[model samples]
Target: MRTIYDIEYLQEVTTEIQDWDYGLVQGMGVFSTSERYAHIELKVYTRDHYTDQIIWNVKEEYIPADLSDFRDEIEEVLTFFGNYLYALKGRREKKLVYEVIDGSFCPDTCMRSFVRATARALVNCFNKERFKPSPADLNRIRNSQANGLELLKSFLTHASQEEVVASLKNVSLTVDFKALFTENELFLINENLYNSIEILKKKEISQEAYFKKHKLITKYGDISQIGMAHLVLILNRKDLLPQVGVFQDEEIAYKFLSC
Candidate 1:
């Protein structure tokens, strides 16, 4: 018996695949545009016990110009292709898979055939289950999360000051900041966010200057640059979450949001 699976737009297209395991096939896709037509860029990859390799990097350049307007359809087509690869993970014959992918998904004409082909393939295998990352990947993620937590703790210990306390009155934090961060960290974050908000409100500083003025970035490295923005959105600027990129680290973001 065959079944159909609904595709999901899990996240913004990224070079890295999250939660990847050995022996699994995964792919990513993006919709791009030229003046004359829309293009769909798709890349598939696989990891054996030793190495990771790209199976194919394909671009379908003949999509109708108006196809870009149907963002959902683009996502659906790409996601169906993703689900097709998910079903084909262990069955992939490198030579045959490349040929199949090229002939079906990566053709020059358009995406209509690719969409229909992937949908039929998806129904044939009927699997859309996510695979867990390998043990090595799991360990790597754990270390990253630990390092990020320590970084946050260190930032709080060193950068927090008394001056930012006054600005706390104007900010209404959506999350229990106390639960996730110490008083000092919250104060520093509130101060930076307050200043950033003021800077944007007054339009007195360039966007570059606002980033430079962030307490987290000033004290820590550039990666921490996104930290203050995350804090701003996570705390008092919940309304702007839709418009901004909030999290830097995925595991840490999950933990922070869960809190």
Candidate 2:
């Protein structure tokens, strides 16, 4: 199934430049993008005393299947901004203003190139794996440490017991649980798991309550928000209701639900 993600656009004035006078030159901006598993952000250019730069940001675990469509839209928007910057340069300065000069002060071609280059770079970044764990590795990690224990705790609450146990079995051979987790911690974790299973079987506790009770294991440290988002997407592959809590952006949650 195709996954849907959210995009956010942000614009701000920044003062990162220190050399050129903002009043005279009024050129030079950065363009950058940040990518996450469920959210993408396109940051607008900032102006200051020295330079101006455009920012494009994307946040996703994997590149969207509709990247070509997205790229076309992004390219158009960037081209518009690049043209705007070129115009600003021409209006503010006086040296051969209307002429398209190579290596000149903020030429139209330069803006176009910048926009296209930035778009391509952002696309490349999105395609690369940033923090996503492989299914086997994720299963092993979740069963081998305090951090993983807490995730398992939460997962058990959200997913079926059979599903959780099946995942654990899939990775048992690959992970050296004895080496990764101390016996005492493992004992406690096992007890918690068994107790959780019993409670779930009895249906005596609410899912939320059980999750909250076991979620305190290990302080839930170092869990990847992006990874969690990715997992949420995988779990909901059958069109199940999503149970994601890692994304700070509501748009991400909305997209997940709508998708």
Candidate 3:
């Protein structure tokens, strides 16, 4: 009995794809196969140990006929990465981060991180539908003064995957990202200061009115909207201070503040 497509024939047929062209995989090892269209296209790896791997065997019919849409397609891929970066802002989990950037243990901000580059590369499958800034997104910095955090939002508003890559390709991305980031930082800082002052108004202590205003913006005082505000008030009001209040760890508070 003879088979319609002999399994042994794949060896010879694979050599044809291997000799002249290299697309699906780099070397020649069966990585995986797609049984989607009832036609089996085997994924193979080339001899190169690194940097040579084929994704899958896509048919010629599946290939895009128009080059015009290619730009948008590429943009979608970039936007996927951008969204990924957005979602992982507060996430410090090393394994969670590892799942994003592909073995990328980003030690830049927090502790050591690990992400796989494959996640970044496969991002082509996920993309932004369209570019639009949500009102809730713009309001983030309005409530907090984290500029680096704010710019991530604005980057979504004014850019898409294509827009970012195009700007970078043109060498204008740095200037644009910086300018936008600076504007957001400044605006957010101002808003934080305004809000911080208002938040303090509820602390109605009679001993300090004029002095409290001056102390807040002073060099000795803390300017942080949340953290430093509590510190400033603690030092200013002896009764409300951690040492006098029902502190969970009064000794720790006293030692930490040196008060």
Candidate 4:
């Protein structure tokens, strides 16, 4: 029954509120007000069981200020997370199949476990008959695998990790291990990948030779797979992968190789 008109009062109350160890759940809702800096402050409280923190200070003027608008905004955020969860589940359910086809589905142990868990949750949420991989799905998966391989080959020949990551910022991929892998794990993988690239750069070892030397390639079973894996690693390190328009189209992959 609470409405947006109460927001100004809530902001004043929040200034005196201290962090609670157990957290608030139902008492708070979405609230918004203007700040002295000419930015709007919006706070949205979520009903998640693990935490009850308000998403604060969203400085956009477009933010919802009315009850109906606030409901729509909340629904949009929920819908995004719902879709993300669904995709994560779909990816996890076919992890092994992806590994076989793509070579680098998830080379890291931690990431693999995370994918499995997420997939398992998805399975539990729906009927068993509802989730089945089709031939068309496999074909699309193969196409993505091939595209990733092409990008990897081009990257190895011409681009640095920084360059490749920056170029492909907006180019969305179906599988991403960035959320699963820890900083330490990423650093180790990147170090090994860099060393392999450095060896290749020296012209002492061929691509085949480099793959044989790298553990991830040997374990995962494809150089192209490793290349795709490296792309994900670069993405997780966001600062390393700034937005660039070079990877805006599929044709650019060939250009990368030609350069």
Best by TM-score: 2
Candidate order by lDDT, decreasing, is 1, 4, 2, 3
lDDT of 3: 0.27
What are the lDDT scores of the predictions, listed in order?
0.34, 0.30, 0.27, 0.31
Candidate 2 residue-pair clash tally: 21
Residue-wise lDDT of candidate 2 within 59-81, one digit each (tens)? 21111212234334444544444
lDDT (10s digit) by residue, model 4, range 80-134: 3234433544432211101000111111112222222223222322322322334
Ranking by TM-score: 2, 1, 4, 3
Candidate 3's TM-score reads: 0.19
Q: Which pairs of residues collide in candidate 4?
A: none
Instruction: Score candidate 4 by TM-score against the native.
Output: 0.19
Clash count of each predicted structure: 0, 21, 19, 0
Consecutive 10-residue window with the lowest summed lDDT within model 4: 94-103
- TM-scores of all candidate predictions against the true structure: 0.20, 0.21, 0.19, 0.19
List ranges where model 2 is wrong by over 4 Å.
1-80, 87-178, 193-221, 224-259
> Which residue runs does candidate 1 get wrong by more than 4 Å?
1-177, 194-259
- The Cα error of candidate 4 at residue 58, in Å, is 40
lDDT of 2 at 173: 21
